[model samples]
Target: MATLYQLHSSMDKLRRSTEQMAQTWRAGDSIILLGATAAFIDWLNAYLEDNDIDRIASIYALADDVAQLGDHTNAKLNLNTKLTAVLSDTEWVTLTQDPQFDKVVTIAL
Candidate 1:
């Protein structure tokens, strides 16, 4: 499994390249890039959902950090929202089953 750090670094690179391409105003190319980025985000969301308990905790902690960044954060660009947006309400409810680190998970949720 790819670590979150690796995913972030790769996504950052993809965004920079996509931004550069968008600057050129080539409509077709820009659309392709947009689709690719969306697909990548979907893959990431699935990965997070399928990860083990420890990894899920790590992801939640990461999300909490973003939430802590305050109200100035953009809804479109917020990592926590992006990450959690993939989860269904039912999936979220299941997370409470793990007895360990209940406090951390609750705070993250």
Candidate 2:
């Protein structure tokens, strides 16, 4: 079990790493690597929350763009799922309730 101090230190390190990755992303660096860095920051934030650490704000501040990229990717995936005929009717109905799917369908029709 990590002590509070250790948890804080880990979060700080993750925050710093995320900041450096964000700078690299801004300079037209490898997006795939930047996306992975953002995911790492998100995982760190979830870990901090699980351990009762107050570091959500810092994590978000350091990786907001990466988080946005994740959100966009998810939205696109959801849209593709809805358009594809892979899901059953029940699944399709459930997906229709999703905002991303609903938006895509509304625009298509």
Instruction: Give lDDT: candidate 1, residue 12.
Output: 41
Number of clashes found in candidate 1? 0
Residue-wise lDDT of candidate 1 within 1-109, one digit each (tens)? 1112212224545544333323332211101111123324544444333431122323322323344444554354454454434324353344433343222111000
Task: Kindly report which residue pairs in candidate 1 clash with one another.
Answer: none
lDDT of 2 by residue, 1-109 (tens): 1110111123345654434333222221111112233334445545434544442211111233334546776465342332222334454345445443212111000
Off by over 4 Å in 2: 1-35, 60-109
Report lDDT (Cα) of residue 93, candidate 1.
Answer: 42
